[model samples]
Target chain A: MKPLDKIQSIAAYLDEDAVDTDIIFPARFLLLMDKKGLGGHAFHERRRVKKGETPFILDRPPFDTAEILVAGKDFGTGSSREQAVWALADLGLRCIIAETFGEIFYANCFKNGVLPIRLDADTLARVRQAAGREEEIVVDLPSQTIVLTGDETISYDVDAYRKEALLLGLDEIAVILRDSGKDIKAFEEGQSRRAPWLRLGPDKWKVFDDLEKEQFIE
Target chain B: MHAHDRPRTLYQKVWDDHVVSTYQDGTQLIYVDRHLVQEVSSPQAFVGLDAAGRDLHRPEAHMAVADHAVPTTERTATLREGLAASQVARLSTNAARHHIPYVPMTDRRHGIVHVIGPELGFTLPGAVLVCGDSHTCTHGAFGAVAFGIGASECECVFATQVLRQSRQKSMRIRLEGVCPEGVQVKDVILAVIARIGVGGGVGHAMEFAGSAVRAMTMEQRMTLCNMAVEAGSRIGLVAPDETTFAYLKGRPLAPTDTEWDAAVANWRELASDSDAVFDQEFEIDVSSLSPFITWGTTPEESAPISGRVPDPAAIDDPRVRRRVERSLRYMALEPNTPLSGIAIDRVFIGSCTNGRIEDLRSAAAVVAGRKVHPRVQAMVVPGSASVRLQAEAEGLDRIFSEAGFDWRHSGCSMCVGMNDDRLLEGERCASTSNRNFEGRQGRGGRTHLMSPAMAAAAAVSGHLADVRDLWPEGTK
Candidate 1:
């Protein structure tokens, strides 16, 4: 995973709210979760340049090199396929500036070192307009602001932990292990004290292990 | 909590209970209760784990199963080759190496991950559950705060058994009015999504309540919660009640004797308080609600079974109108044509959403003495192996097979176009599974999302027909 910080890129627009994982990266190519060779497959059907077919937005002017995808509300809405984020990242998209995002997709973005920045509705409108005018957009993680051309800046919100994780090139588990071992131990103790039944059933293996002592089941 | 401060909704309660600590950046370290994993989304997670030299924090908490990647044709069929086979094989090896228990493809316990988890009683109330599949939200029917997580997050949970989280606003969808016979819970959920638009529940926890919802069976509740993600809500919850306890009472993973009583007592407190205020509220009167069917590519583009395809001219919004027009083009339908009279090429009655034994029984009753149309190729794949066995013991499988529906093994068949089952180019289907995205069934395949009974009726009639119209005697 590449570390993201200050990035400047032309923006492409996908204005449909509830832009789903299937539309971003269809299920047909979701065989193995690889991060490379997926950018071309992004919007696979829509990107095909068949005769009599109109070119996809990305194939159109300005958007040809656009590296920031400005999607609509509820962007990345359906399915938990992380390959959607991988496709965008593979396309060299460093950030997705959207009004809102599906909770799972938003979480996955940070896990894969891609930033899903949520902006207010009015700010998104300006960003979309910026995309039309071919304005270069800037997303600075340390500064926590999205700067459009001409000095106009829209401050965005990133989870405090996530911002630090991005800055430090840390994934959630790495962060938790490095900084939150006490919390994990506390959670385990609490679970044992309060929610013992939550432990998996009397080990199916344990009951069978006794017989396994006599013979391996397989 | 002050008077102005509303009682915490069920979502807030569970979320707050799980947070180990909150960071300045607004991410909280939240403990995970159940992490259900499947083959399609987990192979890479295991790879990531191996690369990181990390092991599952609590392998017991992670329920590994092979669902989406295995064939539904025969349990004995070996997956020795291809992408699906390798993925399934990797899950077994990963589970074995990690000391996690897996309900293997040939095991009687093998079923759709979502179906088997609850059947095993692993999805407890007041817990936060997650899986790599979107239908993992089905577990929220037990009053657990369940949602889907992506593959990378699956790796995160696999390592720490926790997640970095932000809070979601809460929405309470109260299904008021009488639910007449034949209007299944599937109809109620689809109608709710249609009324609330696909994006209406975005960034919120959807907690279903009111008369019609309370009246539904556990299977029906699962059906409702299953598609809540389609509405863009991560969490879909129905407060735990006696019905929930009854279903959990004697299941394999559930407590026994004295512990059972104590556990039920604790779960009884999982409901939202009377004064709990939701950020959004919606009410749907089920008295006159018809069984719903999606006519467009999105689940929200739905109408009553008896209605016509939405006319683009009637839509004032140009963007929406164009989308509807495009959807119609893909679906191979004209604007004013009745949705019912559309011909069907295939019918599928399985998936985590509607592949339970009850779902099988309902579809079977519709096709009991009738044969599937010659033009339609239909199939009934159970959600789990146990569900298949139960349906068989009840002769439901025989009924479906006699009706010309191919009864197959357990897995998510004909849902997301995986496995060996897929629709041909331009073929139309009536599907009980959630999702009607373009080519969700197969490349260039059209889909009409409906209930299991409706799918069965479409199988028998060779077109999208109303189940109520075909079975006038009412649901058995």
Candidate 2:
């Protein structure tokens, strides 16, 4: 993950609400475990060029190279597939602004270094209008502001911890392992003592293992 | 020491019990009691773990299953050369290498992660369960603090067994009165989503309570919580009661002998205090709910069976209107058209949402002595292999087979178009799955979300028909 301090790029608009993860990254490609080169599959159906069909916004000139996406309400909704974030990030999109986002998708964005911004409907419309005009947008992480054409700037709120995570490109697992190792172990020991029923040994596994060994074929 | 005296919701109790420490930035490191993994979303997490030189923190706390892309028919042979095979193989290899318990594809216990976890008694009351799949919240019917996490978080749990998290506000949804005849528990949840909209539960943990909720069986409660993600809530809860306890009493993984008594005593306390306060509250009378189904793309774009397709022009909000128009275009539906008369090409009767044995029983009851409409290709995929065996033992599979509905193996079949069971272009389906998002079933496919009984009725009638019409004595 690259540290994201500032981004300036042309914005693309998608005028549809509740654009789900399946739409962003279809389930057919979910079997590809590797996360690289998923951008080609992002909005796979929409990007397809058929005879006598209008070209998709992302496939049009200027917007074809866009680094920011302005979407409608509840964007990135449905499915817990993080590949939705990966697909956008792999597509060279650095930022996504929407009225709202699915909570899991929002969290997945920070993990993959793609910034998700939640703006009010009015502010979102302004962003969309700016994108429709093909204005180059600048998003400054440190200032938490989006700079549009004519130097018009709009401020946004982000979780302080997430903002820091994005700015520093911190590996959360590494941080937790370093700072909370003892704390986690202590909690586990205490929890086991309190509720011994949760600690299952090989005996519990015997049934599943026996079944697996006996019946490995369909 | 007086923490016990303050009235806290069920979410608070479960959260408080699991907190390991608090970071300076106010993110709490909560210990996870269970981590469930499936094939599709877990492969990359395992790769990350390998790259980080990390081993499992507590292997016993994790379990894996393959359901997302596994073929319902000819499982192994169908997966022999494709991407699905490789993915399932990776999960199997990852689980074995990490010493994690994995229920293999052909194992009798094998099934959708959410379904098997509860039935096998792995999902415990007051436990913190995280899975890579959103439907992990289905376990919340056991009064657990369960939510879905992304792959990065999956790797984090794999290494440390803790998550850095901020607290979500609490919302209590109280369903009062009994559901009218022909209105299944699935209808109750659909009505809630239709009332609350898709984003209604955002940034909150929803606790489902009241008379209707209390009256539901454990399977029904699971169905209710399973679709909470579609309502945009990561966590969903139901206070553990006798229904939950009774469901888990003799399960293989549940506590037994003297330990069972102690576990029950502990679970009995897993409820909201009498005067507990919630950040938001919603009350709905279930008596008025009808058999509900989504006529548009989003789950919120649904109405009672008697209603008509919503007209975008009639809606006041421009954003909502545009969304409705786009959904109507994708669904090929006309505004003001009756929802009941919409013809469908297929009927899918399995998913983490409604693939349990009781769901099968209800659908089988409706399909008994009736043949599937020739125009509709209908199939029933059990939630788990055990669910399949139980259904077979009860002769439900025979009823479905005799009725010309494909009685298939257990897996998340047509709910997601990952496997062979998919909708062809322009094909519309009546599915018992959760979402109705554009192209969710197939690239150009349309979906209508409903209950198993409703889907069965749609199968026989070749259109969206009210299940009440089939039940002459009215549904019990």
By DockQ, who's the top model here?
2
TM-score of each: 0.94, 0.97
Candidate 2 residue-wise lDDT at B90:
81
Model 2, residue B303: what's the lDDT?
88
**lDDT of all predictions:** 0.84, 0.89
Docking class of 1: acceptable
* lDDT by residue for model 2 (B19-41), tens: 89987887798888889989988
* lDDT (tens digit, per residue) of candidate 1 on A128-181: 999988888888889899888899988888877777777777756776889888
What is the lDDT for B55 in model 1?
A: 84
Off by over 4 Å in 2: A214-218, B1-4, B75-77, B472-475
Instruction: List ranges where model 1 is wrong by over 4 Å.
Output: A15-17, A59-62, A119-126, A201-218, B1-6, B472-476
